[model samples]
Target: MIRSSRLLNILLVSVLLPLAGLSQAAGWPRQVVTDNGTITLKSAPKRIVSTSVTLTGSLLAIDAPVIASGAGVPNSRFTDSQGFFSQWGAVAKQKHVQRLYIGEANAEMVAAQAPDLIVVSATGHDSALRLVNQLSSIAPVIVVNYDDKSWQQVVTLLGQATGHEDQAQTIIYQFDQRVTALKPALKLPPQPVSAFVWNGGGKEVNLWTADSAQGKLLQQLGFTLAPTPTQLATSHSMGQRKDIIQLSGEKMSEGLSGKSWLMFVADEDTVNQVNSDRFLQQTPAVKQGHVYPLGNDNFRLDYYSATHTLAILEKRFVH
Candidate 1:
């Protein structure tokens, strides 16, 4: 009786294993609806190439099989010599991610990588939309619009495309846990803060709106973004971007009317610059000594940079 029972259990295990594999297989050759259109992948991508430098960090965070990527301006405040963002450049180097190009998207270099998937941003300076026709011939191409989406949303989208949904879910859960724990420990600077990237000695400024990832993250941590004045709502001097409102010249003081100011992609030097600028010395934030530098890598929020941002904030506000 014991021998017969053992045989039955072994047969049952053999039958169930293949069914489990089949269940997971059924979802493949998946159809992902993107900004460009519908793209179908016959299998999970093994060699992925990201043309958008901003999107590369999220792809790496999820452990996607990114073999190569395009890069941005190199050796700047936020990037390395290869033009990879400071937050994820090390990871890219570790993974042996080849540089497809620096400032422009190159189809030939991308083709040499022999990627099974290619990701392009729908908007931004890093967009490869113009090269879509050429890249599509090399592999299945998907266009993602990161400007209007949060980093988590960007991860979720890339997760689906790269067949790493489990990794995507895990990272977001971890980030949410950190946010929850940090929320209670904070002593916020002030209510209704103004967040922006200030440059050119107060000549160029881009204000973050509630629609941006940085704005969303600040709001998640109990900070409020001051509303853009109605008269300034239509200002699009920097192009039609949903993430920021560009202001310059006489409009600088009118738009920067927050109780406190948080500068993104900045450090202590930037804060000093804001303080010393004669034109900006009278600004409410500068006058009250409420201006703070979030960090140099705070411009593009991804899992790596976002994590760094949380650390910076906790140290700044969590006395």
Candidate 2:
């Protein structure tokens, strides 16, 4: 027979095991539903890696522990030398978040980070969905769809995933408050404005539709978006995407047939170029002299850029 002390020790060990599991379940074993499917985290992640540069802003907004991030083209008007968006580049630097890679997603580079969690965008130039299986072996991965949702929605989803719901709420509330305070102070420009990233030469354009974050923000600020022509809307160069429609040739003029044009990813220089372009002289927006630049920073609508957009609009349109 077992010694009396040994028997008592075994009984004590069994009693504590269930309680330990219960304690773990209380704060952890969190589940988040993502585009890729449901992901279960055994515990709160300490190190997070973002494969989408665009998603990095939202992650940083909620104070997620992002150890590294995929980057975009370096030193562009929109991005810094490290390829982080200019809006949050300083914040990323302050947090010491390293750039995982630029241009393409590299599985080896990501693996080197040894992250507890990996984030990928469902669609965008920065997406790493092709390497999902490879990344899953390293850590739990979640795919977020940014095109269909507003920036606020993306932050809320990420907050839930990263266990920063309160931080997310605080940011959202602050942004909403600013938007609310500014809404009544401004006189909206021409109704039904067409917003797009002008392809510079007037040869092509990436038109922002109602579903895009930029479009939603404009609408929230009380500007009605002109409905895109049915024909141009159905047929486009870029494949079916909810965010932007790529148009060129005759479609460029026909698609931009709005009372006013608000060019995103543009600055005052872009406005000057559009004003002087001979080919676009007859366009309704040009003929009416209603073309306005929404600034280069308006290209992405993360929390920082979105707030900047509000300031730009308020200054331009406030009575």
Candidate 3:
């Protein structure tokens, strides 16, 4: 399919531009009860530092005043080592947000920003406990566990932590409305679509399940995840058993089967890369020509990315 990015870019600007006022909804002396424990803010933080890149999308979506934002761990998705995902680059640049340390959250580098509040996830590439303990010396730290929560919950937590819960709700509501509006034009194949991301430069493929960025959005739109071949699921899950699964291209065709496929990539070039793989080329998606590359800033998705995902589906299937 051809790229139609201008449609969604215009949609995002029109919907999110007026949210600046929502960030000003201050709830002073806010006490957030997180998985680690209760951390209380002295006041609504004017300057915020987010140590988790996943949380950065939520923080920015709510219009919180973040001075610095950290990047995600390497290979976590489309995120990079710079502690910034290109998906949110526009907002980060507009706010003049300092790109903080990526990799594991570094206490010393985060302290340099001199932020009033620091936010992170309990489980991720970076240890939230470590950040809470180390960064607490500099400012208040709020840690949230996202293992069992939906993306909306994560955004709501950030909203409460930064006194922007209303803005968070507003954003989530807008997304819901858009999903409903797009429903009329959307269609799905008989079987679930296996949505995954392929890295063209590195030749790696990762399955996006219910717990992942793509899975969450597509499942919400009444689509099911592709059935993981019994053997692949066992091999991929191992002992821990997480929602998202990763596999090499050779094994990918064995695990994925359906009439349609939604592939996520950094650009169109990755599509060509996937096509060149003999094993990947054998899948039913390839045979039927149902493969579609997810457009726009979707390689790594978060709160803001969900809106773009909807836009992509609406344009692709909605006549």
Candidate 4:
């Protein structure tokens, strides 16, 4: 009787011990301190709501499903002009994102969704803080600031929060490898002064200097930026209007002369207008086909956006 009891006890302990170990391995920690704040994740968030463009892009990059998105702008509205959001839409569909937009987001709207986690970008705005606090009342809020850190760090932070740290790191590594391989193949010309012109119609063209995201991306691509004298003067002058003149047509061509020009036309009409303008047609870049027409949506500088741009450049420019 004693020997039979001993054998039964040994078998029960052997079977139960491994099951307990497995459970511990599968359960991730419930909370972590992020750059934004303390995040308390309850049972690996299954439903996520993303409010910022960067956060939404990151989530899609990792094949994570977003139950709700705050940026409700349709991809079609900007795709023809820029193509960034449209590419993201296809990826989002693949991830099964059923809920599209969170129109006029407020605490009430977020609370009603019952999300497992709410991800937002800290923009140093009072409204942003209010939204984060409101969302925290419903569930954990993880804030990420892409402007303050490297893209790899942003991805890793999101991965850690979502229980996919390993996947995020791998993606970052692969992105670095792609960049390294492409650098050698690039036959870049001498650094030329560049300007980004957006034809907003009615003879008003919006010109962006080195302060913009597109400008930063251009610099990364080895382009020199034009001097913004008005912007510089306004900083020193008292009660001076901080606005720069919007140049179009001949003025636009002249403002961007002496170097390759990149123009972002928002509407199809604007594109046709620029193509038909004799002054624009006579520019150096126009004659040489060096003028790159940026799609209306290509300005987003998130993880997916960067990756997509790399792929597009590789296909179009690199062999």
Candidate 5:
């Protein structure tokens, strides 16, 4: 009887040992170092908070659920108004997105949500970093440098941090396939000198060079960049503020005589004002209907923006 009991115990141990190993394999380590900083994760974080709209969008794209999102549009209803997050369902159905709009994030509010991890974009605001530092006191904070990282890199890093690398890679592969399929369909005009205009309080226009993502997109579509006074002057950053000769209506018409124009406006009033301006009306692009208005509000150089920008370009310019 004793020998029989020992045999049964041995069998139970043999069966349970492999199950323990499997459980350990499934549960990844709690801490990971990202490009921005070292994140100390506590267990597999089920609840996550994202500060940037791009990060939020990227997470959703990878099938990762975010408990809270900071910036984008006010409500899910208005998200589609810009056509960026239009198909992301409702705010209520978006897992645990607390209806919180913080142009600048509040650390106290983040703490209140009690997220297992916090993700933020490194951009125009330094407040996000401060919030991350503060939140780190309560939980792990992972800062993603959105400006420098490519879309694939961002998605991969986020997947690694969230333990969803395979899932993220699958989504990225699908998106790449779609982009590849759509590239051949675009017919770009040869030597088409395109000018990108960004309208704000002041009627500002920016000339995209080879380095700019928008410029690269245009290049892929076979459009050439228009040479402006700044382009003629000393070479500077793609989107840098430079001292360029702002031509009046008469001069602008003559200056942009031969080239096609691609204009981007924030609001309808600004678009109307630019259209009504005599100088802008004289430009070749305006006369020839080459003006391309970027209607999406989520226009940035980040991963999400790049993909959406490509889709918009394909739809409007390609077709």
Candidate 6:
């Protein structure tokens, strides 16, 4: 009798929390501004076609039924990766979403999926503008660029666009609450923490600033940017703006010797390789056991990825 009562209470809370959240969202026929223009969604989308990996992952995180995804590539876990992309591949598979396309956006393929809403993002896709024009003729399209926005902001936009606004706001509220609670527990060191990714070149490393997607998360944790000065003036590789800076060999050695490190490399072998590299031999993080891996395959973080990142930080860094 006692165990059954406990289970029932747990289920009730789970069901009621979402109901309570939904009550706070505005009524149906919602409108959200998109890159294309003002988009008004008359009702919740039943079928959504996600044209980018980031959007696919974001949509799935909020319980949006993404009917198709652009994850048919060789590098994708959906191909055979067994959750190489932890955020979406399994969710996409569990939802039985179709693999619509890989490297290029296919309007016909996406159309055949019979989607009511098509989501395209400017990340990782070459022809966003052309695809938007093609899909607009068939159905409503929202062009989301997840690069510059905070994860909370991105999820809020996604929720509004997909009719999960209440849930989106709830996630942000809960996350901010958690952060507020966790702030008093961080045991930061004297020097700053620098996060980086190696290009697999001899000694080249790309450093992240406060504005970078991952760097934004780090900033919330009260860690100062290692190299200091959040943004610099310069346009360079991948046109990544000024937030990501590159260094090689002796230059990298000088910048990160005193700071702890966060490595966004894909796996343990690569982590070992980066630690052993001659250029990184003097890194303070490698010496003091402060070097940490975000995830082996989690090179680029999206909404779900950032959530996982925050959870891991809370567990590892807190007393």
lDDT at 48, model 5 = 85
- The C-alpha TM-scores of every prediction are 0.90, 0.89, 0.80, 0.66, 0.67, 0.79
Task: Summing lDDT over every window of 10 consecutive residues in candidate 2, give the lowest-scoring window.
Answer: 17-26
Q: Worst 10-residue stretch by lDDT in candidate 4?
A: 236-245
lDDT against the true structure, per candidate, is: 0.87, 0.84, 0.71, 0.58, 0.57, 0.68
Candidate 6, 1-319: lDDT as tens digits: 9999999997886556544545433677877787778887788889998877656776777788788777534554223353225555677678887776666778889889888898887554433557787898877898876656667767777887887876776666666667777767877654578887777554577777667777887788787876543232242236754346676777676655447777774446666777788877666677776777666444556666676766666766777
Summing lDDT over every window of 10 consecutive residues in candidate 1, give the lowest-scoring window: 17-26
Task: Choose 1 or 5, whichever is better by lDDT.
Answer: 1
Using alpha carbons, what is the TM-score of model 2? 0.89
lDDT of 4: 0.58
TM-score of 6: 0.79
- RMSD per model, one decimal: 7.4, 12.5, 7.4, 12.0, 11.9, 5.3
lDDT of 2: 0.84
Query: How well is each residue in 144-167 modelled by candidate 1, as lDDT tens digits?
Result: 987778898898878878888777
Q: What is the RMSD, in Å, between candidate 1 and the native fold over all Cα? A: 7.4
2 or 6, greater by lDDT:
2
Q: Compared with the true structure, what per-residue lDDT tens digits does model 2 show for residues 150-190?
A: 99889877877787776777788778778888988978777
Q: Model 5 residue 57 lDDT?
A: 68
Best by lDDT: 1
Q: In model 1, which runs have C-alpha deviations exceeding 4 angstroms?
A: 1-26
Sorted by lDDT, highest first, which candidate order results?
1, 2, 3, 6, 4, 5
lDDT of 5 at 142: 85
Model 5: lDDT of residue 280: 72
